[model samples]
Target: MADTLVADLIVERLERWGVDRVFGYSGDGVNALMGALRRAADRIEFVQARHEENAAFMAVGHAKYTGRVGVVTSTQGPGAVHLLNGLYDAKLDGVPVVAIVGQQNTSVLGSAYMQEIDLLGLVKDVAAQFAQQVSTAEQLPMVLDRAFRAALATGSPAVVIVPHDVQQQPAPEPAQEHGVVTTAPEWRRSQVLPFDADLQAAADVLDAGERVALLVGQGARHARDEVIAVAERLGAGIATSLLGKPFVDESLPFVVGTMGHLGTTASAHLLGHCDTLLIVGSNDPWTEFYPPPGAARAVQIDLDGRNVGNRYPIEVGLVGDAAATLAALLPRLRERTDRGWRDDVERHVRDWHALVEIRALTPADPVNPERVVWELNRRLPADAQVAVDVGSCVYWYARQLQLPAGVPAHLSGTLASMGCSVPYGIAAKLHRPDRPLVALTGDGAMQMTGLAELVTVARMWPRWSDPRFVVCVLHNGDLAEVSWEQREMEGDPRFADSQDLPAFPYAAYADLLGLRGIRVDDPERLGAAWDAALTADRPVVLEVLTDPAVPLLPPFPAGAAKLEQMRTGLQQEGAAGRHAAELLETYAAQEGAGR
Candidate 1:
């Protein structure tokens, strides 16, 4: 067998695309590709995940953490099908990822062959920007390059499908022929700024209002200084979408914190009272938390025009790079001299900080989940990376865990996929082994896929430089988020059969893998447990026995209605819900007292 088959050429092209690693699992469909990867191991690395789905999640995480186009591969049929969940995660969160999937021989495709699948059709939705199949060796170069370019241009996942027979073909060296096509793997981002007229229009709106509020999202990540400058100029209070949390320093006096269902009371107050809104790089879907339709005159700035007025009606839409747009608008904006709005915003933030402390200290059955996250606020290292999964754990992560400046905390933001924390943490750690990573996940999510991904951690931790990977499992035997959603949204009691999770010894499983295990049942021990796990010699599973009854309450104005719904649902639970009702009331009382 020649060493330079089409498979070999494919690996070479990936190297040219600047992909250092590819996450995947093997099957018969991709046997040729695997052999080529093995032969070219020095240049491109291969990471084997526990499952194909997890491999896809790793790819998404890689893009989010590394700020590069992530690459993933899998066989056709079942393997190709499993990549959908993670591909959706990448698409929904605007992360760039490229999936190279193997297909059955072209001859067998229409014959209904054993492993045949309509590969192009399968990835159409998730890889909406680009998806193509390589029919000839000569087609490989163009297909691969376009996938990379399209992914970067659109900030979404792309796909390249190669047939099993196509993989065995000799690497094509196309000469100057009529039908031949070739391309280069290169992508560059432009410093796109808004038109001068639009920038002036945006400034006019901001100059008119005294009580201005700025809402930011992940798109503002690179423009932190500019965002703060704009907020300061307008005497504006800042509130973030959860995806934008890590980009801004949470300790800022006029920063009201994240605004949404699991957001801060200060954020709710800021949005509720503001007369003018300036949205920067965020299309957060929580419309209820925004200033009511006619309450505020809004100006939105985003590079992607599609999100200009996506969640809110705005008087001005400035489509441009956030930093450049903000800088241009700054010259036209007159600085606020009243300082009254700034002082009120700072006071609200100060009150919020104290209220959170009281909420974290509230009594629970064994341990308050908020306390587990609150303790990490001060202990998080300057360089630590955080990966959080969806569920009640996200509520704590969103509201309690105050990220240190420059620390990145990523989750399955828009897709809200559970079981992402383990895979995301692994990908971040694998990319930068020198830095420590902490994953916050609920027990329901832990049981879904985290338990299996631990084996991947056990297999790889010995190769790491820091060797510190902490997986904090909120061992509350319930699907708390959905349960609360049912109560809050539908005014229904918790259906124990659907919400309860089977007990699993997360700590013991870590011990089985020869990693450290620490279980915390007492609230007083949360800080010590966090300290122990952060400083451990190897991977540690910090399984926290958290309370499921702690209410998932939104900030006020919107939260008041949800609070009534929750009480109504609890009233119907009879004896089964008395303890939960009491806990809910206690939490509600604490919020009032703290405020």
Candidate 2:
């Protein structure tokens, strides 16, 4: 038998790093690694994916659910190129994923071989770290260590490219071990300059003021108690950003609601009217809450000092963890002299909830996107994991779906990439097969990136117990809702009507995978179909046909400006424009139909 190659050693190192599964597709250049994986099949399982994008997405889902580094591999050239989308998603979400890509043989460096491409240069901007393997036996361990450490340290994706020939080379007599430890930078508890005085000053401001409001962000993930404590101390109303929604239970007394474009009307009212706005750990970049020219005065607290004054001019900028800062400021906070303001804010939130009920729940001829989300929220178990894609679905879920306190909900790129739902759903199912996993995806998004994963899920079902991956596809067959709104503002009333597309039978696609598939056209059958899928002890897909006419008003209005700019750039009808225009029309139609 030939001596164990460097690829075997690399696999051993991956095992030591606690990686049990690696998601990717196999190809010629990566044959050595595949051979090693086959030899060590008992130690680590290689999850062969239909697409490299799904592999990266699966890694993201795994990292989100397990809080551990996710691993993926791909072949040279086109394979590695396709992984970039998912890698970007991992970077934007602060998820740790290690990606290994196969490269041409070492001798072919700069020779323009068939599969030769600058993999490192391709991913340098997005990857936290990148490495190239020189001689497999001598350099594999060092490169792997560097990649793993960089991924864990920054909570981002790391890429490593291995040459085909080098991977098959035998190790030297004494293999060198690279020892690198990954650790997070210590977050010191420090009070900002004059923060104590500022707290007292803020308290005084609140003492005189009648209404107070609190806004929380992702930085407040673990500071739920501190937020509630501060809200209780000041008798103030509490609201959260879309990312911060899971921090506090919706049932809390002071929980006003979410803030932004898609935010509750009551929460927006409280933010607009409050004399003193306490922003805890939010960048507050969304313009729907803080529009230009006129907004309320605010006190912002964030660990990163740079984010403090970037949005709104701050009355007080406190630098520290939200939990610690809020805890320290709690003692200095005083109850508002007039309790009527608090009462008014609470009433506004209630009224806003009622308004949402009317818009989302009123029976319409076609299914309401809001009704589907509300029903899913009601039927899902408290601990069920939800991975939501971008576009109208995100808007609907962010505003309507109330996640149970502490349950995990994964969103795609903070950059807001489409087609992340299926991969995210697959990863969630892989990580927590026992827990019910749900994906809320729009037809456009599902078709864009995740359609291939349906086959991957079917193939992997035998390995998992009760692979209850439920996907509720909101099919609108058009993307005109947002586009129509934008056109209306541009003096083109007919633009919305021009963007419409034929609907694909998504149920047929699901059925092809031999999975339970249900199509729902009416609002009434949506609940029953969703419930049936969730209860089914297998992978199920529920295709709910929603109206494409409903416009998706995003939670943050600031994002709309960026989309409008994109729409303008792609207004022409060339290959790129036609594709872009088609997507936009489909998205708008979905939104309009839902409305």
The prediction achieving the highest lDDT against the true structure is 1
Q: Output the worst ten-in-a-row residue range by lDDT, candidate 1.
A: 586-595
Q: Can you write out model 2's per-residue Cα lDDT over 1-595, one digit (the tens) per residue?
A: 2488878877888987889888899998789999999999998988877788878888887887787889999999999998998899888766689998888898988999897888878887988455555554566776787788778766689988888998888854453356432322222235433367877766666555556778887768768899988888788888887767767777665686667765665666677677777788776456547533235566778876767877776676777778878888888877555678788877766665665565576544377778889887778788788888887787777777778887888777375777788888777777777777888888877777767778887887767776788888888776644554554345233243545545688787878888888999888777788878988866888898886545444422233453564455456324534544554455443333332
Cα RMSDs of all predictions? 1.1, 6.2
Return the TM-score for each candidate structure: 0.99, 0.83
List residue ranges in candidate 2 displaced over 4 A.
1-3, 128-136, 172-210, 291-308, 315-320, 335-338, 363-365, 480-482, 488-499, 553-595
lDDT of 1 by residue, 1-595 (tens): 2548999888989999899999999988888999999998998889999999999999999999999988999999999999999999999999899999999888888998897878888888989999999999889989999999999999999999999899989997756788887688888999999889988889999999989999999999999999999998999999999999999888889998999999998999999999999999998999989999999999999999999999999999999999999999998999889999989889889888998988898888789999999998879888999999999888888889889887889999999999999999999998899999999999999998899999999999999999999999999899999989888999999999999999899999999999999999999998899999999999999999988889998877677767889999989898978888998887777666645
lDDT of 2: 0.73
Angstrom error at residue 251, model 1: 0.5
Clashes of 2: 28
